[model samples]
Target: MTEKQPQARVMIVDDQPMVLEKLRLVLGAHSDIVLHVASRAEEAVEAARSFRPTVILQDLIMPGIDGYELLARYREAEELAHVPVVILSAHDDAVAKERCFLLGANDYLVKLPETIELVARIRYHSGACISRTERDQAFHLLMVSQRELAAANVLLAKLNGIDELTGVGNRRSFDAAMAAEWSRAQRQSKPLSLVMCDIDLFKRYNDAFGHVAGDFCIKRIAAALTEQLRRPSDKLSRYGGEEFAIILPDTDQAGALLVAEGCRMRVEGLAQGESSSGLRSPVTMSFGVASLSPTRDSDMTAMVEAADAALFEAKRSGRNAVRHAMEMRAGQRLNA
Candidate 1:
């Protein structure tokens, strides 16, 4: 099926009333063209900007601004640049034609050409202008779509990294962060610390209270653990159910121990009230602190293992205590 095209807009600019009337009469015969007339150059510029004509018919000699200056103005304007301007002049001088071309006129014609020739030129230039406008609109829409897609991708990445229930970094995010921090510490020869924290008797707590209350308890403990670290480089993640991990970038054993102890004290301070199920007490968490001057040869999993082993010791030594990986190792060596 053939699609119907919209009528092309034609603007005639001339100071002479007779010339304007003639052009208007010629264009009025065609139903596919809309005619707009301006008797002054300033009025022409204003009309072109507002009307957004597909083609412009401009007179070379006019009051206030001549054809050459008006043509220059159209060429300079971003919105008017795509519309073709055909100059109408009484004198068909070679120098005038060359000057008009240099000023960006699309075509130069003596006063008025034959009706058929004028219509053909107007149709050709108007069609070209329409094609250019369509292409520009399509390109702009594509750019907007690309920007929206990029924003959606960023939001997806954030949602993937976050734990939905606790609003903390999930296990996948923790692994990525740990690998990156490990490489950074190795490159700078700085100490990096990791703390594995578990709620003491969390299974018992969950068994005594409902899972709903257990969930609330974990969220509160996570917030308390997050509050212990002061450095922007430090990160905390929900390692698994009832267990959390802290990344202490550039922090040594002493600093890590201080942060771990702070988290322990904070969790112990959380208010507890008696429930209908059973008698409730304040929640306490155990911490396992491990710091290492990371080297390129060291395995990342070994650090996690050390932290986990320290955590086991903390649990063994009558729960709710903080244990250092190095201290555990030293004690083990002495016993051996």
Candidate 2:
């Protein structure tokens, strides 16, 4: 969608109604301008408050609260101070113009001047005012954009193990999270658990549905798995093609098993379309869980290997079952 351009707001302060009308008629042809008319200095100040003009054209000779006083008030106002004000009067004396300039009148113009000269001055002053406004706006926008970009970079850095296709954390992210959590667990002496999950018959499913469908299936499963981990310390990531890993900080074997079951159930409920071969069922995942206390001398590599082995056993036994690593190594002595 195209954005709308902003128009410049201008206020003309003069006691004479005829002069105000003339000024409007001269500048009205410029669609980018919004002209405000004020007949008194007090009225001009009120108009300035409401209109928030970028430029003010004020008459020097007024009945009360003359242009000089109005300019002083405008300078005192924090929001109105930056706005440029030009003095307009019938007195074309150099002394009067210089006094007005010293008192903060941006420029001085004689009344009933040539139309071309009037338009030229207005355009020139307005252009400078608009340029400054645009510079301030652009600086603010640049700051905002820089902040957003910094946030995005932080997110990207935290997303280890993310799958490039689906924008999910990849295996590397999962491993780093596990290592950090393990250290924390060792310090607090809390339980830590890991879950390794694989898509059932993913190779066959991919053969029947094409790689595109396979990718879709993986993304859906990854999203579902991530959704299951709502806790701040829980970590989920794509382990590899058609496989994912989950880290459950301060979770026992039973807790990990429940999380794995929930993820499995959610993936099975996705109701994806049929494969190209039209024989395979909708997507489903199998999980293997391992839990232990991470000690000072523990080896995370062995624990992850044990979880991976359990996942292989689950696949060997049945496609959609969850297996515990301790059960698989019941006859063998395993450390860490």
Candidate 3:
């Protein structure tokens, strides 16, 4: 089925009674056109706004405030800014027509135009104005949608790197951070530290307490370890089921060992807090510390392996001790 086009709304503004009556009779004869008349230039803007005419038929010369002022006023009004204006003047002066065009008239015609030509011009301008308005609204909506989509993509990227259960960095986040920090430290000739810690006897704890309590214990331990790292440069991430890693940039071996011991003590204190919550078993963490100032010969794998070896030693010696990766050579072993 063919859709019917919308009716054209035409507003006529002229000072002469004869001209107003003539335009009313000519436009009112058409069934597809809605007509409104304003005899005074001062009231044209207000009348056009209320009527919301698609095409304004305006006279160039009027009694009080001239058509030039009225045309400028219509262009200034935001609601009437895009509505087409056709200047119909008695004087066919080129200078006057140019003045009307500069004042933002869309078209100009001398006195009594042919009925067919007048109606065609009105309908054509009316359709063009409506199309431009719809096009602008659609462009505005598209811009809003694109901005919203960009924001959503940023949020999704952030959420993808986060650990769901503990609200901390996941292993993927840790890997990316380690690569970036390692490169930065090597370039700046600064020391980078890694602290790897695991909950001691986690399987036994899970057997004694249900899996739900086990998850709760892991969350509490993660929070405690987070509290021990004071600087914003330090990052904590869940590297495994019961294991977590901390990255400390621009820190020496001595500083890294202290941080590991602090985390150990923090986790040990979790037992007392758990007691209030009805869990009886004590919780302790074994920590491995490794720190190095990267040289051209040093690699990321070497740093990770050193920390992993130290962690194995901590687990071997007893579950609750903090072992420095170079403690055998540096004599900086810390046990609790």
Candidate 4:
């Protein structure tokens, strides 16, 4: 099927009332073209801007800002730049046509061109202008869609790293962070600390209370543990159910022990009261602390296993104590 062309908007700029009326009367007979006439050079460009003309018919010798200057103004306007301008002058001088072309005129014609030719030029230019406008709008929409997609991908990646229940970094995120921190510590020869923690008697607590209350307890304990470390380099993650691991970059054994003890106290303070009785449920946690001056030869697994072994000792000695893996090794060496 053939597509119909949109209406052409033609604007005539001339100081002569007769010329303005003549162009208007001739062009007005065509139903497809809408006409606007400006008799002063001062207002012609502004009028065209507001009317949004598809084709401009400009006279070269008008008063106050000559037609050449008016043409320059229209060409400078971003909104009017794509609209084609046709110069209508009385003289057919080559120099005058060259000046108009240099000032960005699309066409030059002797005044009072044949009615058939003028309308044909206007329709042709208008159709091209409309097509360019549509193309620009489509390109702008495409750029916007690409930006929105990029932003959504960033948000999805962040969400994937976060634990939904505790609002802490999940196990996958912890592994990545541990590797990066380990490399940094090895490069700098700085001490790095790991603190592994488990909620004491958490199974018993969940058995006594409902699973929903247990989840709530876990979230509260996580927040308390997060508050213990003041350094921005420290990170906390949900390593397993009711088990959390802390990564302390550039921290020694003493600092790690202090942080673990602080976490233990804060969680113990979160003792929630039962509804049936005025007694609070015991909310103590056990901690296993390990620190190392990391080397390139060593990997994260050694540190993790050391912390896990210490955590087992803490659970074995009593549910609420803190155990240090390095300290236990020194004691064993002395006894041996």
Write candidate 2's Cα lDDT for 1-336 as tens digits: 875435667788898889988888987977767898888787877789899887888899888787778888888887787788878899889988877877778888888777788666666677777788789899999999999999999877865446686676677777778878988988998988889999999999999988887887777677778888879888787888888888899999889888988888777767655234233357777888888887766767777887888889888997788888863232232643
- What's the lDDT for all of these models? 0.86, 0.80, 0.86, 0.86
User: Which segments of model 2 are wrong by more than 4 Å?
Assistant: 1-61, 64-69, 72-80, 84-145, 158-161, 269-280, 327-336
Give lDDT: candidate 3, residue 283: 82
> How do these models rank on TM-score, best leading?
1, 3, 4, 2
Q: Could you tell me how far off, in angstroms, the CA of residue 203 lies in candidate 3 after the best superposition? A: 3.6
TM-score, candidate number 4: 0.72
Q: Candidate 1: what lDDT?
A: 0.86
TM-score for each candidate, following the candidate numbering: 0.75, 0.61, 0.72, 0.72
In candidate 1, list every pair of residues with a backbone clash.
none
RMSD after Cα superposition, model 4: 5.5
For model 4, where is the 10-residue window of minimal lDDT?
327-336
| Candidate 3: pairs in clash | none
Best by TM-score: 1
